[model samples]
Target: MKTRIATAVLAAALLTACARDPQPASLPPAPSATSTATSTAVAEPCASVITRMSERERLAQLLVVGVDPADPDAAVRLVREQQVGGVFIGGNATALLRNNALDAVQHAARWGVSIAVDEEGGRVQRIDELDGTLPSARTMARTKTVDQVRAAGRERGAQLRARGVTVDFAPSLDVSSQPDDGPIGDRSFSSDPAVVRAYGLAFAAGLRDAGITPVFKHFPGHGHAEGDSHAGQVTTPALASLRTVDLVPYQDVAGFDGGAVMVGHLTVPGLTDGVPASLSPAAYRLLREDYHFTGPVLTDDLGAMKAITGTYRLPDAVLHALLAGADQALWSSGGNVSAVLDRLQQAVDSGELPATRVTDALGRILPAKHACG
Candidate 1:
């Protein structure tokens, strides 16, 4: 274990030394799908906002809390007082309910907060009634052309944007090689890596065309995992297989300017020391060094997932995530966000966690928020 950690730390240092800032590039064109929004100008530079914020406020910006429709007041408090950076709408939040809640939260926030939803279509659809449904990713890959998939993405994005959603966590990039795989299965585009890449890019392109930021998810692949991360920590394929097969889509999408990536909770034996990727600095190092992803890296739900809660509770899990290199820690189960924010402030004050980590995280997160506007 000591040797492995040393090797991982060395690899990260080397990757950092060799890393170059990525040149901004336009998304590759699909048949009829062109990006509606360009990176011409950010309305408010994230750097400016970071300079003006207090340490606690800056830390708040790195948290994406899950809002429940049942407790609208608590959700509003999270945004208004805690100054949470974003909200993920789920748990009985229909379109109307979600929109109403978002309106209230936005009204409470001093700055624009990202409104995200898991609108992947098919089974993972969060707001089916409001956004409507398309088709499963597998079915879309099998039956539709790449252009058609792009069109579907545009259509979905339009619905989400209309309802005030800025981020759509769709276009699963995990190569579903095994049909009977526990978590991914039909959520994936195809068993073939090439097919998954083509369709995933198309779907992401469509989302970008509609002015919704597309977040490609389950980084380093989840298709081959034997168990679900939501239930407990699941082991994944070795690094070689992940780089060649699962990580290809992420590497391909790195050139596009308007996309984010969500790291999952699976434990990679050789890479993360059996810790879930969301809380593994080694896993994040791989994403930064191996994949060259510069955009915001969000965690899968932090509160409900047993992989996290079964081990560390709220504020501890949140701290580990930030320390592990995630730009945003997503807590989908409702709780007093202020408590977590306070703990983060204390950690930073006592030299337990560096202030630069908060600033660096905000540097990545604020730009995404700016892009949403």
Candidate 2:
């Protein structure tokens, strides 16, 4: 009986030892100071992927590519395959395209993607493919009071919201100092900077009223650039003159909560010795350090102009633009999307571009999105 008791005691001891030796625990690292605060925290895999990106992925995130809204696969590919952050809606102004556009936007959004469109009035309008397009900024500048412009903006924004577009690149703040400048002559609100400021603010307010966002473009002013920024290298001496005259409109929009500012691909000797504004750190500094414009900064289409296409490889230009200050690299063909991203990843891997800068820039873009929500 004592022998039996000894065996049972031994078994009991063994069970106690087993209970004391617990399996290894699996716990995540504690939140660190370097990590994003809980309030602005991004999703895990996405945030991790974004933070610990291979050069390929960083470039992909910087790009906002254009795609057909009708093709759900294209939109899904942009988000899932390419990991693109945004998609620019591209379709002719037609009933079919317009009718189907919103559905496409909803699909893209389901995958945590954002949608953008060029809803600038007149020749630049995209939403008008289904409804009637509004008159040019020049036409509006001639007859409209601030109230009238504001009212039109609200209505235009409503149309945009109904179509699933949240961002409108509008209110050409260029002063139209050069009457003969073909592309912007009709797009500018007025030759007077004060009038431009009033109209630009009203237009922005109108969009805000409808819970939509606006992107004011061609910073430091595109008014005096001698050629179309879309087609070729545009150079202008008035870039200096615009510091006070044409840029005044931007000064008014500068306080905009979530508005994005697009830098044009024009050469302004006063600001950038020879490099276009879109690729110039000096020009970007004027926005970031000098004026303290703390918002998402986008480059005018990297694929559109000869200035960009003729001089720098689209991928290299995209890297330079982001390194310089532009947050979102705009591209049209969607093909350049991958190449642009690859270059960015390469730059990050090479340590030529700091990851922190890219993160900060992307962070700036998020607020505008929140504003849209």
Q: What would you estimate as the lDDT of candidate 2?
A: 0.66
> How big is the positional error of residue 171 in model 2, measured in Å on the Cα after superposition?
1.6
Cα-based lDDT for every prediction: 0.73, 0.66
RMSD of 1: 12.6
lDDT (tens digit, per residue) of candidate 2 on 1-373:
0001122332343234223322224321211212211122344444554555554555565677766544545565666677676677554523314555456445544224557776667666666646678877788878888899999999998877776677777767878855533667777888898988888878878987887777787787877667776567888665557686767787755577757788888788777767788887777778766666777788887754667766666676677787777778786545556556666777777777777657766565545565223
| lDDT measured at residue 49 in model 2 versus the true structure, 0 to 100 | 43
lDDT of 1 by residue, 1-373 (tens): 0001122332333244213222224321111101111112223465666667888888888898766555567667778887888987664346324535567777788777888877776666755655566788898998999999999999889878877788988778988765533378778998888999999999999999999999888887887776776677778888877887877777787787899988888888688777788888877778877777777888887766677666765676778788778888986655547767877888788876677677777767777767223
* Residue runs of model 2 more than 4 Å from their true location after superposition: 1-58, 69-72, 91-111, 177-181, 371-373
Listed per candidate, the RMSD to the true structure in angstroms reads 12.6, 20.1
Q: Tell me the TM-score of each prediction against the true structure.
A: 0.84, 0.80
TM-score of 1: 0.84
